[model samples]
Structure formats: structure tokens, C-alpha cells
Target: MKKDGQDMRQEGALKAADLEDAVRRADPDRALCARFLPASVRPDVEVLLAFHTELTRALAPARSAAIAGPMAGLIRLQWWRDVLEGARTPDHELAPPLLLALERGVLCRETLLRILAAREAELDPQPEVSAWRKMMLDGAGGLQRAVGEALGVRDAGVLARLEACGAAYGAGAMLRHWPRLQQSGRYLFPGDEAGLRGEGNAFLSACDTASLPSSARLAALPAILAERDLKRGSTQAGLPRGLGDRLAVMHAGWKATRVFQRSGAAAS
Candidate 1:
């Protein structure tokens, strides 16, 4: 029997909720960051993040030779491209809402393509430090900019800050996941542990979060969380949780407040 319109709507809602839960479990830090977005836009942002998580999972087999060859990964990547281009219907759980976002103009096709290109770059064999850094910047920055756009952030200056913070956040994440990445025969950095830490720290320091306008702070909150987790080892398991993560965001917010006050005084 054909499902009624109400049944179809209910199914779609359930699928979206399931995707949100999957994203939260797969990437708790990003899920935490999504909480700061306006309620109206939060679901779309989470769906976008969920799409990212799906991309990462598709590459998992390629990252580990024992699992399978690159064929599966390539097919998965192409599937996403086809879905985004409207050449194919979305078959996966996350793809429906993602396609809806695209149809609604909440997400840009070009930006999503840019993001996919960044991930594809990771398949390069033994990428040099410069190449690795480029991948991080392009992949992470592109996604951040996409989220900002969805949030109605159109100012060039704010978008630039979002990209910078996103790059730094990506660097920290790579550093944190280095151990597993190394074990899988993939290196986040082309060098040793010390070199990875040094590179990631430099990236973080170069990003002036205090320069972020109040309007863009929520969009850039992950950078603050990344900074807090940078020095710590991965053995602790999945970024600071509960009160710890909350406190880090609060501290960053306080710093932003101070900057705003100083700027006001100077203007006066």
C-alpha cells in the first residue's frame, strides 16, 4: 500500500532525528558546537555535519588496508556527488535531509563540492606537510563557511574569520586523532609526534578568536573546544565532556566579552 503524506512526513522526521543522534555519537564536539546555533537553523547544520561524518566513514576503509581497497571508497564518494547533482535519488538515511537542504538553498552545491574535493585530496599517497595543511584548511574551512552561510552570515570579514577558526579546529582534531591515524598507516602530519603538535599549536595561535565578531562567535565555537583539547592525548577518549566542555566554551565567551568591552571603550 502507498504511504499517505502524513506517514511520509513522520518518516522523514524520524530519519532526521536518527541522523542527529548518529552525528552526536560520531562527533560529539561538533554536536556541542551546533547547540549554539539558533534553533531554527540548528537542524540543518546538524544534518550538514552528519553528511560530513558520513564522508569520513566512507573513507575509513581506504585508510585501513585490512578492511578493503579504495574501490568502495571511490564509489561512495561518487554516490554523494551524484546525489548532490540531482542525477540520482538519495538512498541513505542522511542523504534525504541533506538533499532537502540543497533543494531549499540552505546549502550551496559549489561549497559542498569544494568540501568533497578536500576529502578526496586525503587519498594522495604520503602527502607532504604543505599538502596536508592545505587539505585541513580547505576541508574544514569550506564546511565552516557553508554553516555560516546557512546561518545567514554574508559579511566577507565574518566568513574569513570563520574559515581561519575552522582551519585551526581541524588542525587540533587531526593532532588529537594522530595515534589512530598513524596506526592506520595514515599520518595527519608528514612528520613525527612532536612535529604534529608544533604544527597544530602554531595554527591555533595564528587564529585570533578574539577578533571574531559577536555575531560569528557561535559559528566559531569549535575552535575554542579544539584549543582546549589540543595538548591532551587521545587516550582520554572523545574530547572533554559534560562540565569540562561547557566550561571551555564559557571561558571563550568571557574572553570575547572582554574584547567587546575594550573595543567599545576605545570607540568611545
Candidate 2:
């Protein structure tokens, strides 16, 4: 029995290490942010991020698929939905770690479905801007909500703020990836050229940074990174290279820590 238990423990550890490596490779920015999280909750956050990466990548082939047909992408998304709904285990390697995360309450079925739905919407050739915006907000907001839950944040108000932060983060991400979308003959913003020019600023302006709970701020740190990337004129071409990007991430972390400290002092 002891030997069996040891083998199981080793297997679990190896699985976790693989998940971490996957996250690091697929979503380096979020993986970097995950480094600042408390050890106990870090894996939970990493799993959520890894799940997001999986959903995002699953749609990559469809982005450049001929407009007349998107069946391939649709099928991929359906498979993810099936897995989340417990139709069957995922055939992909990423699914096992994600399943473990789900069992641990690091993720929930409703939020996972929301994320999948957002990916499905992207398959639309001419998705309504409003619908797309709503999907992005839902997907991003759900992620923050899950992170907040993992961090033991139960306040409805704080969760709502986190959702807003997530939306802002999503908007910034869309901007960052604008070049890639354009190159693929796909666009997400709602408007003419003039409107496109203003969209990034509009999203940044709408972020309600002040209302976020300090304890949950780490969940929204990506918003700060997004803002910095926008200010630096980063696009799908790439983010600011080297030291500049590193400093931006560090600054965002420092800001979150400072806010948390202030909130703690006020509570006392």
C-alpha cells in the first residue's frame, strides 16, 4: 500500500509539472503573472490560464479557414463542450490536468462553458460586434470569477468588479492581437477605420481600477499589462521587447501588492 501511494504521488507531481510547462509555453504572460501568486493558490490560477490557452489555440486553424466553411473549428469547440459537460474525457493531453482542476473547484462547469462559447462565436464570419463584446466579457469575466473563488473571495461586489477588470483585460488583449486578426482577414472591433483607431483607448478608459478588491487584484493584473502594451504601441506584431516588457510586468505586480497593502491597512 505504501509503495502504491508513493507511485500515485509521483504521478500527480509529474502531471502538475507538465501542466506548468504547458502554461509557460502557451501563455507566457499569464504564466509570468502566476509566479507572483501565493504558492497554495498558484497552481489553481495556472490551471485556469492553461484552460484559456487551450480554448484560444483550439480556434487557431479556423481563423484562417475559408469563410465559406468553418466546420473544422466548430467541431473542435463541440468536443471541448462535450468534455466540460462530462460526455467523455478529452482525447487531448491537456484535458487531464484541466479535469483535475475542475474537481478541485479551481474551475466550474458554467464558466468553462462560457469560455467555450466565446471561442465558438469567433468562428462566425461576421459576428455582431455587440454579441462578440458580450462573449468576450463573459469569457474573461468568468476567468476572474474563478480566480477570485480560488482565492476565497466570496463578496458579490468584489466579484463584479473583478468581472469588469476581466472585460477591460479582454479589450486590451483584442487590441494587442489586432494585427494578427487583420492579417487573417478577421476583425473584432465594431466600427469603421475611425472607430477602430479609438477602440483601444475606449477600452482602457472604461476599466474601473479603483473598485477592485486588493485581495483579488492579482486576478486582474493582466489588465495593467494590457494597458502598458497599448501605451507602448504593441500589436500582434509583438509586445515591447526585452527589458521594457519585463519592467511593465514588474510594475503591474508592484501596483497590485501596493493596493493590497493599502486595503489591508484600511480594514484594520
Candidate 3:
């Protein structure tokens, strides 16, 4: 079962490439992640983000689980086990950095176990309806706390903020994807779709309306606002008026609009 030396190196290079690509994709979140980090500790915070980025993708490919059935989505579970067990048949790209992270002996094993447990909710079909939310909350917190430790932040203030951001991001992601989970009655929270949809509708309603842009377009507009806004206005300057309306005109005129958000939001 042993592989050739050249093949091992090639596999390692591919994993590293994958990891780098994932990192680049998550770069958009820097504004949010950096907000809570102290000037001195932000570098470490950035490093920990690499961990979260990897975890997200680790779950993403499991989206194929929709047709594959919830239980069959256990591909990601095996991948995590494969990671922690150091069985690098695929040669984990993260292994080198994580090994270096462990050189200081700061990250806890319990932290990873919590991540595994939380992620298990997504895989397990038999979980009690009410147990899903608690599993996700606790599991997400565990991973964040683990990241905090690895980053060497001992101050109580910074720790709490990091954990808060972690919980918020984790909960938000699950909520964003709740509809699909609801379809299978496999929600991360313990509720049926009718109940879940009402709650989701209410929660989403609470988000700020001002986040929309280009112009003060309708809530359902497809403006690609962030990048478009940047092009129209400098980082030092605020957004222009009527940009949303203009973008709407552009899309509507050409009939070129596509889905604004991802599948979960599209389902909602």
C-alpha cells in the first residue's frame, strides 16, 4: 500500500495548493475577524482563521450529501478522522502548519473532539430534534476556544470576543443553510420546517436593511454591492447614490441576473 516518493510529494503539493486557495477565498472575512482582534494579537488571529477556513471547506464538499442522503455525508467525518489520525494517504496540506502549531503544545485535544462532535450533527440522521442546536453551539465554541489557545491569547477580554465571533459565525452559517437541512428534517436545530422557517424569517428580518446598496433597491435585488461599491467609491469614500438602481437596470436590461446568495438563501 506504500506510495512512490514522487507521488507522495505531488500529493503534498496539491493539498498545499488546495489549502492556499481556501485561504484566499476566506480573505473577504478579514474585516470581520480583524475587528475583534487586538493590534498585537491580530497576526495570531489571522493564523487561527486558516484553521476555520479549512474546517468550512471540510464541510462544504459534503454538500453533495443532499442527494447522497444525510447519513452518507459521512465522507467529511472520515476526512476529519483521517486528519487527526495522521493517515496522510491524501497527504493533508494542513498537517505541516498544524504540526508547527503543536510545537508549543497549546491547542487542546478536547477542542478538536468538540469540533468532531458538532460536525457529527450534520452527519447523523438519528439525532433528537432538540439536540441539534446545542450540539452546534457547543461544538462551535469548542473549536473557537481551541483556536484562541493556539494563538496565545491569554487575556480574558480578547478570549471572550473571539469566542463571541466564533459562535456568531457558526450559528449564522447553520441558519443560512437551515432550509436544505429542514427539507430532510435534519436541521441543526430541533424543529420542523414550518417552525424553523418562521424563526428563520424573523431572524433574517432583524439584519440591517442598509446593507443593501448601489441604490436603495428592493430587498431582493441582485446588485453585487460590495465589489461594485468598491469600484464606484474609494475605500476612503462612501458609496454613490442610485448604484443599486443602476445595477438593477443593468441586470434587468440585459436579463443577466443570477442567484445573489448561495443555495440555502436561494431556497429561502
TM-score against truth, every candidate? 0.80, 0.79, 0.49
Q: On residues 1-268, what C-alpha lDDT tens digit does candidate 1 reach at each position?
A: 0122111123334465565666677777778678666677788998888778767666777876655766677678888889888898876656777888888888888878877877777665455888877776667877887877786678887776677677778877766766666667553677776776676667666556666665566677778766765777465444446587677876765665456456558868
Candidate 2 residue lDDT tens string, 1-268: 1122111123223366666777776666677777776678887777678678767765666766666366787887898788888897666655776787788776677777877787777777354667756665667767776777777777877766666566666666656666665676544666543443355455445556656667887776766766665564434355433676667777777888777668768989
Candidate that scores best on lDDT? 1
- Residue 135 deviation, candidate 3, in Å? 2.1
Candidate 2 runs further than 4 Å off: 1-14, 125-127, 192-206, 234-236, 239-242, 255-268
Per lDDT, what order, best first?
1, 2, 3
Candidate 1 lDDT: 0.70
**Candidate 3 structure lDDT:** 0.43
**Would you give me the overall lDDT of model 2?**
0.66
Q: What is the C-alpha local distance difference test score of each model? A: 0.70, 0.66, 0.43
